[model samples]
Target chain A: MIELRNNELIFQFPKVHTQAVCRIDFQRTLRIPDDNQEYPLPPGLGSFPINHVDDFTDNLPATWKEHGGVFIPMYQAEALWMNFSGHYPCAIKIAAGKINAVSGTQWTKKLSNRPQDYVVVPDQPWLDGFNVSKGCVRQFVAMPLGEGYTAEEQLTGDAEHGGIQIIVYPMKHDVYVKYMEQHRVFNIGDEQCLTYAPADEMGLGAGGVMRQEIYEDDYGIDSWDQTSGLRCFVHLTNSAIYQKITGHPPLHKPPTAQEYTDSGLPWFDYYADKKALQGSASLSQLTSVAAKKIQKGEGTLDNNENVHPNTIKTIKKGRVVRDGRF
Target chain B: MTFSSYIRQSREGLKAQDRRFSVRQVAQRIGVEPAYLSKIERGDVAPPSEGKIRALAEELNEDPDVLLAMAGKVSSDLLAIIRKRPKLFAELIRDLKSMPDHAILRIARDVRDGDW
Candidate 1:
């Protein structure tokens, strides 16, 4: 079952399909200053308000309703992360404007093993941005399309679609049962929700690299039941357009990196057991959001100063015993 | 519950009771893919044929007739008996619908042993 409740997507699976469950939230976070230095993971401030575009067909741009999915409001240059809570195992494919976020290839309906274009969840708790390197990701920051900031624009040279896109396929029932018993891997699920973007829509651009890992699927590619998949499209609108169209005041604007740092909240680090999947060649080549902003003659962004990099609390996974005096 | 769900429960119960009655084991015994059997359990597909249901009944140690009934199928043997005298059998079966089991048993005993 898939439901949109309280601005988050909750997916539940039956006992037989236990590995097909997950919850997804689009988390608003600080736009890290992209000064070519990797940064620590930022905190999730809140969820961007999301609703079905069909609910406001009359008021919305016909293209949005025609695309037929959901919408969330975003500010230009604001950063966001996909928070995935898994209860079982699942495979998720995410794309921004039809560009594969993992492999940087054009989107395909099927999951491929050649470049491993999808993320295996439960091992991967959350995705902060595009997979641009091993043990790090370029944070996902929103930008106006056609300005050459988005990966889609840089790679494809077309600004046709602007929003994030996602699709998730569940593990086969028998494979899930077999793997759970054999490897005794943790049970959890993660699926992707897509976003459709027209010209005026906001696009996700690569931002500062943060310490986040996307795990390679330990189970073979066939573990996922390609026959059955869940897909959702999420659209992006500016806060002004969001309120004028939806009639709800926009979500409280996200705090800038400077403000968040001054507030004294610590960034985080998630330590996992396995080696993360290495970044793909194409993804590593895209320009950072801050660099693009400067290239476009916008002075270094406001409130984007780097935070004290040392102040991060490490959240360890499993029994990651530290070396102590023994 | 559907025949699919009921059989699924039976299989699951068997797993709990004995060694294991995984979808693969039961489906393989019944000559179907585990995936197909899984879908059947979820009611995504229609119940299997009478022969397969009987095979499933054998593997799960259930009564073939009962399983067939749940699958909305009459055993071929029952179909043959009904086919012998379609109109009369239809009337007889319909007439016996609400009768007490003892009454039907007596009628059955008379027809089988006492007289033609």
Candidate 2:
């Protein structure tokens, strides 16, 4: 018997010519922090919350809960958000469980080889109203590319400097297997070819709005390999929704190169203090007119700027140190 | 060696090989006209002036010195900028190259407007 629970498809298959039963489950959805809440985020990090799990899991394996059940986590939730919202940088975590230690071990071993820590089945369920698979379970350890930055670094305000920080939640082996099992038996009716509409065209129904065309990617899961895991569709709406969900403000207008330079934030200076150390160029040459304006009390820098007395002190100290080094 | 044999070997050495890039693609990357760049690549025209080469390097995301070397030209000012801030130099070049002509025009317009 097989069952669909919380977007994961669980099934019991008998060992060849044996009475023993093997159970398998797949993860389909993830959870992320609510938009209104201001949770701690890594610098330049953005995420959107996805609430539609059943829409994705309408075609479930038969009696999925009978064998066992699976549920989505915050990380998987973020993936769904990226898929529908078109956010480039995103991430999610997955958790699965099994009825017996033997089944759990076998499932874990099979899932261990999967790249990006695709499988992370929990030993026990954290929430009620969920059925745990006795013999087999699996979870996901998914995140968008470049999402592993430390909290301190995230808070340091350097996110915009790097190429748009893109995070992709690659489809995993278990997800493919689960999709095959359910799609193989189900009659999808008119939904056979899941048509995605542009986000603007999606109707606001009981299921909220179903954004379309947001998940378009040049490559599909079929093309995924060791190197291909970094690839995923970057949706534009995902950024808006992520800002909405994470309570982070959006970039109201595109920033110019001069604007970035004028921000006076610390940048990745490849030359370090080469010119300054050489004493060939004055600070006036390196500093933007905006910095000079701020120094002269003619204008104020943006909130992102850290023009503290200590910051100046550190620069002076660096100048002294570099002078000593020379 | 015989004069004829030496001449044959020297001619072979002087003959340039086709390096895979089309003139148009290189011109597009460097933000120049295909016809002009073609002439330069074929040595039918002399290398660009120093200021033009610096701008071309910024547009193509190439080290000014490398571009100059390829064209058999060099300038001390471009070399100084490269030496002072190699990463910034690279970034500025990339940014300039990646920006569209219209975007550059718009930025120029905005700068002009702000100046007024």
Measured by TM-score, the strongest candidate is 1
Candidate 2 lDDT, A246-295, residue by residue in tens: 34453333232234334542211111211110111111022222232345
Error of 1 at A28 (Å): 1.1
Q: After superposition, how far is residue B88 of candidate 1 from its true place, in Å?
A: 48
Q: Write the per-residue lDDT of candidate 1 for residues A161-200, one digit (tens) a residue.
A: 7888777666777887787857776453433345545325
Chain A (alone) TM-scores for all candidate structures: 0.91, 0.17
Error of 1 at B68 (Å): 48
RMSD, each candidate, Å?
20.6, 26.8
Error of 1 at B21 (Å): 67
Worst 10 residues of 1 chain A by lDDT: A317-326
Predicted candidate 2 versus true structure: per-residue lDDT over B42-63, tens digit per residue? 5566776766676656644447
Instruction: Give the per-residue Cα lDDT of candidate 1 at A249.
Output: 86
